[model samples]
Target: MTGSTGHTDTRKTALVVGASRTLGLALAAEYLRRGWDVIGTVRGSGRTGLHDLAEASGGRLTVESLEMTDPDQISALGDRLARRTLDLLFVNAAITRGDLPIGEVPTDMFTEVMITNALSPMRVVESLRPLVAPAGTIGIMSSDQGSIALNTDGGQDLYRASKSALNQLMRSYAARYADDSRTLLLMDPGWVRTELGGPDAELSVDESIPGVVETIERHQGKPGLHFVDHQGQVVPW
Candidate 1:
């Protein structure tokens, strides 16, 4: 039977990337509360929010140390997870430092942002591909800034380019594996009040996640490149 959150009591597995805090933690908690076995990935130890999530999940959750830049670690984790099937895989980790205009942004910083935000998630997906059940889903946390149709003036070049690249990556996955029952989606969580979004953003993480979760539910039967907002509206892609 389904629980209070509409998730079934059946033991499902989910792997959440960048689950140190905020939306990531909230998503993990909601799944655990609904009886899904959750695995959260964080870069380091001593992160308070992750510790709290582990404690709150009551043995239903496991946290793994991950460095997105390191391919070897991702491969090892994939090997470890290969014995079990996964129901959901959420790629949420991304970086945006110094939003200075493109011309002034240091090349190294821009490269790092692309590596973390674009390439890393693809690598994770590749590593974890074997673990996803044929009926499972894979979601990439994407942004509206990535939409070529929506771009007018390109101010935040690095961030915009990175997410746009991610959009392409997700699209490629869908095209190559279209016959596979596993669903692939590029979701825009909207402008949320968080460390990455700042206080002036349009929505809170709490407000965004539930609706995003609902969107995931609604699209459970249909999948491809779904550019959806928190309110379930299709954002331009």
Candidate 2:
């Protein structure tokens, strides 16, 4: 039977990257509330929202330190977690350049956004893929902005480029791992109120996350890549 939080543990584990606050933290909390063992990462050694969640989890959550931009950190993490199995792995780190257009954005800022939103997540996935059970799911936090097919209006230029690049890169990664059994996902959680999504955003953490977690649970054991929203419907890409 599922717990009050609507998930059955079976001692299943999840590794949530970039889980310091906002949606990432919420994801960790939802999983912990559901009785799943959660390993959540914050970028640095400093205290973060995830630390608070860890303290309250009654030992179901473990907090790990990782700077997603640093490959060395990722490698060390791989060493530490080599023997453990992750039933779900989600990469949720991303940064926005404050509405800067693609051409107007500074080179350094562009680089940071792309690396954080795209390259680093893939690096983490490649390093950690072996640790996921064959039936597990690996998901990356993407946005509807990433959909090339849906970009007719065009805005959030730098942010949009980063996500679109992420979508493309993950597609390449998927092609490379075409025969792999684990389910792969590109998740679009919608425009939610958060530090990143801005206050006027339509959804709340409470509104989007349950369905997000539920969608993930429903996709278990399914293979190939899906770009889906909080409701598990496809997002064009």
Candidate 3:
């Protein structure tokens, strides 16, 4: 692919997890538009918007299947992509069970949200970190809601707690791999209008994802973990 610079684009590969629709799908498309080879994962055999993007990508986009909650699926995906080197591995998965206070949340509901939003993403990162290039990036779709220091108006307690847990776990992961050269990012895409963000969200996917991708690209060679928003502004810890 030749870019606007009139030079042949050295294609970088990106694996966008949970990319069937919404923000994940948009991220995949943005990367593809920027001359990157994109592998986007959906949940099942059924067709999705990502499949549509792949069909029109002239072979630049490959669609994979993944159930993020299942460790077996994650391991299987890691094995399947073992030969390919990835420039970016981004895991984007989140769920919210209404606006229930944390205390009122059922044990099962709490477990499901935690696993989908926090544990499963970390599991995927751990399983697939080997496939990423040494100077590549590993990012998770986090939210500003996760910032404890900025939680002035308290609502959506369960969702807040889950994102906070995700951030904390990423911190631990960064600490454990402190010497690793790869860049780690916790990206806050803001309140984009998606199923998860609801119809009343302030920003659309178009408004959020390009900046998110650019932020990731700008931080490519910078080692260590950063918690930042779509515009590359540092989000509070």
Candidate 4:
């Protein structure tokens, strides 16, 4: 990693945002398995799947609190880990309603989806960017539906719009920091079977995350952003 301003910690460390369950939990667990110390965030004051995972992590994992939608919480999270140097900061955004067309979706529902999927994650990234080592990696959990050029079939409606917005936001963020040596990744983990991905998804978590982790490793220390899939293949913008 290329950091000059981050803390001088020797252990490999990762800050996995929204890590209370599903893909986030799995990713945190995988990072631990790969020999990194993990700090995972759950939204509020309740026991979650991540708590159990943390218990079994043999002290390799620490659970923190964050509600990505809130600026106060984001500020608090930044302060809480300010001195810490993060080897990897992966912002795992969430939520999708149904197959309704964008025109049919309610305004409130659309707002929630866009904020949760696009805006909040970027807020998290901006707040935590200072803590990431210059040699570190920053990632956002994206989906292939975000590909605007690949929209021939026109399914997933608002979900596609949110991810596309996320991709564009990250692209702008990357452009602003183009000279920085840190790696920026928009990683699509495929349609894995999760609460978010639904039961009908083509891939299982066990089948996908290992490749996702590998793709992140491949991008480490590389400057600029890559919109890539779990297998390190680039997706069309």
TM-score of each: 0.92, 0.94, 0.95, 0.95
In angstroms, give how far residue 154 of model 1 lies from its true place: 3.2
State model 2's lDDT. Answer: 0.91
* Deviating ranges (above 4 Å) for candidate 3: 1-9
Q: Arrange candidates, best TM-score first.
A: 3, 4, 2, 1
User: Which one is best on TM-score?
Assistant: 3
On lDDT, the stronger of 3 and 4 is 3
**Across residues 53-154, which tens digit of lDDT does each residue of candidate 2 receive?**
899889888999999999999999989988678999999999987986678889999888989998999999999999999999999999999888988998
Evaluated at residue 68, the lDDT of candidate 4 is: 95
TM-score comparison, 1 vs 4, better candidate: 4
Residue-by-residue lDDT tens digits, candidate 1, 1-237: 256798756798889988888988888887877778999998866675877888877788889888878999898888777666788888888878857888888889989999999999999987787888777888888889888888897767889999999888878877887787777777889988988888999998888988877777677756555777767788787
Clashing pairs in 3: none
Q: Per-residue CA lDDT of candidate 4, range 79-171, in tens?
A: 999878898999996899988987899999999999999999999999899999899999999999999998899978999999999999999
**Top candidate, metric lDDT:** 3
Question: What's the distance in Å from true for residue 231, model 2?
Answer: 0.7
In candidate 4, which residue ranges exceed 4 Å CA deviation? 1-9
lDDT values, one for every candidate: 0.83, 0.91, 0.95, 0.92
